[model samples]
Target: MWMNEKIKASEVELTGLNGEDIGIVPTREALAMARKLKVDLVCTSLMSSPPPCRLVAAADAKKEAQAAKAKSSDRVVKVKEIRLTPNIEEHDLDTKKQQAARILQAGNAVMLVVRVQGKEGAAAKVLLEDLVRELKEWGRAKTGIQVSGKQAAVQIDPVA
Candidate 1:
C-alpha cells in the first residue's frame, strides 16, 4: 500500500545492500534484491517527499537501534551526597573524601555539605572550602561539586 503522504508518482524507491540507492525499482524487484542479499528491506530515515527506506539485515538493524538506545540511556545522571563537620578530623575527612570519590567514579553527582557545630559555624567556609577542594580532586573532571549556602549543612550529594 502507498503511504498516505504525497510522493512523486513513480514505481518505488529502494536502497541496496550496501546502502546504495536503486531508485524507483518495482516492489517485486526490491524484494528479490533483499532476498539475494540475505537481508530485509527496512525504512531507515524520514523523507518528507519520498519517505526513504533502506534494505538492511533485519537483525543488524534491530541491534544497531538497540545499541543506540543503550548508549543514550547510559548518560542519564544520578545524584549522591556526602556530609562533614567544620571541625572534622583530618583522618575522617580523608575517609569521607574516599567515599565521595567512589560515588563519583560510579557515575553520579556528589553534593558536599559541611555542618558547623557551635562557634564553628562562623568559620565554616574556611573548612568547607578546604573540604570541597579536596573532595573535588577525587571526582576530577567526571563530576561537578557544589557547595550549598550556609555552612551548617548536613547533606552532600555525590551525583551532582
Candidate 2:
C-alpha cells in the first residue's frame, strides 16, 4: 500500500491515469508523473521484482474500496442452526420445519443437528433424512445426513 514518495522500489511497474500500462520506470519519474497528472502513485502489488503501481485519485480509490466492501457485504450468506433431539415430538418437528422454511425463504441456509445417545443414533439419522424430505419444497439438502458417534447433521440450502 505504499503511496507517492513512500514507495521504496528503485523502479516500479507503472500504470497510467486511465489504467494503461506505462511499463517500468524509476520511482522518482513515476512520482513526477503522478504529480503532473494530479493523482496518487499507489503501489498496488509488492510481490513482483518491480512493484506495480497505479495512478489513482484519492477520492476514486476511496470510492472503489467502498464499492468492493459493499459488494462483498451483499454476498454474505448466513447459516441458521436448528437443534433437535432424536425423540422430538411431531408438533415440535413441524415447528422446527416451519422455522427452517422461514430461514430458507429469507435466503439463508439451515443446519439441522439431531443429538442422540447410544440406541438413539439410528433414530437421529432417520429424523434428519425425513426432515430433509419434508423441507424439499423450501430448500434442498446440501449435504446428506452425517452421523457421528452421538449426533447427525445436515445442511439445507434455499431453492434458487
Candidate 3:
C-alpha cells in the first residue's frame, strides 16, 4: 500500500517494498486494506513481544526482496552430487573428481557419495574412507566432510 502510507505503530508497523514502513493499522483493517490494494501482509518483526506485520504488494514486495538478495549475493551455492565406488577405475575416479572440482570452482558445493555394491559392501567403510581422503586432498581448497554414512557424503564449498 505504497499509495496509502500514513499507517504507523510502535508495537507493530506496516512493511512495504525494500523494508519501507507504510504505517500501522489494526490487524483486520490492515489486511483488508492490503487486499484492497492487492498487497500482502508480511511480518517484519517476529521477535517483538507482539511481533510486527506489514502490508506490501506481494509481487512488488517479492521483487524487492529478490533484488536485495541478488545484491552482493553469494553465488547460490547448489548441491552437486557425484556418485563413486570403491573399485572405481582410475580414469573414472579422476574424471569424477575433476567434475566435482569444477563445480566447487564455479561456486557451488559438491556432494560426493560412495555406494557399495553387493559383496563389496563389506569393505564399504574402507572404500568410502579412501575416496573421501582423495576428494578432501583435491578439494582441500574448499572441502569438508558434511556427512559420513553407509552412503557417505562430502561437501566442498567454493574455492574462494
Ranking by lDDT: 2, 3, 1
> Please, what's the RMSD in Å of model 3?
11.0
Clash-forming residue pairs, model 2: none
- Candidate 2 lDDT tens digits, 1-160: 5678888999999998787998999999999998897888888778997999999997886776677678877866699999999999999999999999999999999999998888998999889889999899989999888998878899999997
Say which candidate scores most in lDDT.
2
Model 3, 1-160: lDDT tens digits are 2223433333356565467766645666766767787887666555653456766667866886677677858556688888887678878978987897677667677777777555565455565556556656445424543334456455565545
Clashes found in each candidate (C-alpha, N, C closer than 3 A): 18, 0, 6
Which regions in candidate 3 have their CA more than 4 angstroms from the true location?
Answer: 1-71, 118-150
lDDT of each prediction vs. the true structure?
0.59, 0.89, 0.61
Error of 1 at 110 (Å): 0.8
Greater-lDDT candidate between 1 and 3: 3
Candidate order by TM-score, decreasing, is 2, 1, 3
RMSD of each: 8.9, 7.7, 11.0
Clash-forming residue pairs, model 3: 7-23, 7-24, 8-23, 8-24, 15-54, 40-56
- Quote each prediction's TM-score: 0.47, 0.57, 0.44
- Show the lowest summed lDDT stretch of 10 residues, model 1: 1-10
Q: What is the TM-score (0 to 1) of candidate 2?
A: 0.57
